[model samples]
Target chain A: MDRNEPLDRVKNRRDSALRALVSGVPYMTWLGVQFDRRGDELTAVLPFDQKLIGNPVLPAIHGGVTAAFLEMTAIVELSWSTMWEDLESGRISPDADVPDSLPRLPKTIDFTIDYLLSGLPRDVYARGRVVRSGRRYASVHVEAWQDNRSKLIAQATAHFLMPRG
Target chain B: MMVGADDAGRDEQARIAQQFIGAIPHARALGMQVEDIGAGKATISMPWAPHLVGDPRRNVIHGGVVSALMDTCCGAAVMAHPERPRSTATIDLRIDYMRAANPGQGITARAECYHITRSVAFLRAVAMDEDGEGPVASATGTFTVER
Candidate 1:
């Protein structure tokens, strides 16, 4: 963020950064997590996969995987907020000096989840809100929903030890 | 661990635990195995695999994998409860991760459904790595009991 780039370049850089962020985590790729990005915001998507179901009888996505999706969203969103600020401040330039690899994400301290309803056999989406983010700590709340946003499949709150900038 | 008075009852619970793991597609994907089970308790383990890694450079498995294992094990414990339990669903789970699981060490989780009411069961679980001296994560969860 040392200097402002063209708006188009900023958009492309943000998209690439998010993609790189997802690709950086092998488990996220294994879960087939994708992101729909708008500027600095992100909504994580977990595509339908039979391998994700924990209950064959109910044909529902595993509760653990739902938790994973929420955790991943919280993580990426948390990391992105700081990185985005760095990008805007021109502290690092992806075009010239930023390393090919992204910085390490914050370490998770604790995660608590509440399952509202069984996740149906369909695509699921999650959005993370950064309840608080500081130089050394962050707290995030994430919720996953299917067709009806009002009806959440699950929601989670996590506290992470943010990596020092 | 609560051991059933009769060996036959113990074996039957073990068989049910195995069948339970086999029935879940996600459990299969994780290569989960039934280690032990009895009335109101269950133990499950899963081996480490590349696909389960959260941080490849660090060789750390994903937290979600452990969460899933604990969740499944908790439900299994509820299913094996002495009461008229038929099926179960996770209502809420709180997991305090002490540390990341070792890279190549398999993880084992043991859960005990200590109490059950008309429609709810309470369980506590611990996840340990073969290489660790202490638990990798400890969890307490509430689940719905469907009799």
Candidate 2:
């Protein structure tokens, strides 16, 4: 079997696993999150929902909701990135029979969010980058924006406990 | 401050705090309830729900849910403060997850606005499930007070 064949197969399985993981979380599903992947980068879209608004006076999305969105994005991005790395390094076999379970979900150790601007009542987009990943830990940076990516509504940094394969 | 004016101010602040919580759609979605509020302090609770679970294998609530709870509690604490502004926005928040919240248990968050300046309020909060001694998470945050 070609080495690339297993990698390709694992990638296909990962997509289905990611979908299951997102649909399993009630809040994420309710947020109407849609994922777009380009290479190693992942973007999460949170469609506008009236129920997400925090301040009716300002008509702004809740800060807590924004934080949660960014945190989830980082976690998902990190999880997928790690899986890719594992496949490349032979840490996980492409033929492993664990079809019903995803790789161990990363546990959040700490997270910091900075609210740069009030989130408007529109679709919000978040992108996550894994700053560093090790056997036991991963650090991710994420930003949420509406209207314009340069004018981010919020930015966050988080550390997660990665599972050693 | 006159005693009568002080009491009235407190009452009005309390009303505003309640209204603020009620107006938040996300809080409503999470079933977050304001349990108590005092000058510079607030307590909020979230009932356990199946949808909030992050790891089904372990039956643990998602960490993001805990972060949202702490953030909301901290905001409420700022609003209940005697020196609270007419409005405020979260400037930043840092949360440390000590452990996963126990499954099938309601979580409560208690927060205090420890300091205030002309333009900012500083707050600290802790979230626990049943056990007040062992916290599921802790947070520190700052909010911008609109003058």
User: Which candidate leads the pack in TM-score?
Assistant: 1
Reference-based lDDT, each prediction = 0.85, 0.80
Task: Score candidate 1 by DockQ.
Answer: 0.84
Residue A106, candidate 2: Cα error in Å is 0.9
Q: DockQ of each model against the real complex? A: 0.84, 0.70
Q: Best candidate per lDDT, number? A: 1
How high is the lDDT of residue A122 in model 1? Answer: 96
Q: By summed lDDT, which 10 consecutive residues of candidate 2 chain B come out lowest? A: B1-10
The C-alpha interface RMSD of every prediction is 0.8, 1.3
Candidate 2 i-RMS: 1.3
Writing each residue's lDDT as its tens digit, candidate 2 over A20-40 gives 657656657766787876655
> Model 2, range B27-56, lDDT digits (tens) per residue?
888888877777878888999887777776
State the displacement of the C-alpha of residue B47, model 1, in Å, after optimal TM-score superposition.
0.6
